[model samples]
Target: MSIDLQSKLTPLPRLYKEITLDVGGEAVHLIIRRPPRTVMAMLLSEARKAGELDEQDKPKDGGCAMRLMARMAASVLYAPDGVRPLYDRKNPEVIENLVENAEWLLDIQEDVVGALGANGAVVERIQGNSEATQT
Candidate 1:
């Protein structure tokens, strides 16, 4: 028996997440969208561009890292409950917090890199250790 070509076709899996943060005793929510191929392409292109940053690329307040985090935050993030249009939440304080407390961000990066076949170790480690098991 031969395999059906249609049955062999599968779409790439995407992983989405909702991350919550506490700032000044208020809940801040982020609906983090998983990057599809197009978004990933844009990210890669932007990263390459970042490496060639000139003097003008620097923020006046010396917040290059915050700016980068803000850009990434803006790209994938859906606003919290009270916010609208997403851009409203991309402020300095919110962006600073995202850059400061970014454990989940690293996890997402590892997952994306693993899914893209760039970092086998991350997937392997997660699989081998069962780290993703939730209580």
Candidate 2:
């Protein structure tokens, strides 16, 4: 006997983005997923610590931004070589490498988040076809 099972479709699909970097002249890509609610909470915590958030509902400047960016990159950036969680770096050499490339890492992270928001943004135009087209 054969059986089939299917679940109802969700209104939205998860989003993913890929960024390529030059590491030792070799191309490396970090694929990132749009962070879920839990992950977003974590990110906000880090941002608050880094002075990126404030009670006045504005961003503040602080020295911890680099560290926060590195940590955020570690959270989202996935490696093809299976090196996981750069935030918990134990290898001194890898830690140094990431520190040296902190700016680039932040750049990639921002790019991924930006693209995810820009491309995945939704719009509703009642006059248009109702196939859930985007703006």
The reply for model 1, stretches above 4 Å from the true place, is: 1-15, 52-70, 80-135
lDDT of 2 by residue, 14-124 (tens): 436656777678877766645444554465465566455545322343233344444445556666444343354324345346757654765574554443342221111
Please give, for residues 61-94, the per-residue lDDT of candidate 1 as tens digits.
3344334434454555555442222542335566
Predicted model with the maximum lDDT: 2
Model 2 Cα displacement at 116 (Å)? 7.8
Best candidate (score: TM-score): 2
User: In terms of TM-score, how similar is model 1 to the real structure?
Assistant: 0.40
Give the Cα error of residue 111 in candidate 2, in Å: 2.7
lDDT of 1 at 11: 30
The regions of model 2 sitting more than 4 angstroms off are: 1-15, 47-53, 57-59, 81-86, 89-100, 115-135
Ten-residue stretch with the least lDDT total in model 1: 52-61
Clash count for candidate 1 is: 0
TM of each candidate vs. truth: 0.40, 0.50
Query: Which pairs clash (backbone N, Cα, C closer than 3 Å) in model 1?
Result: none
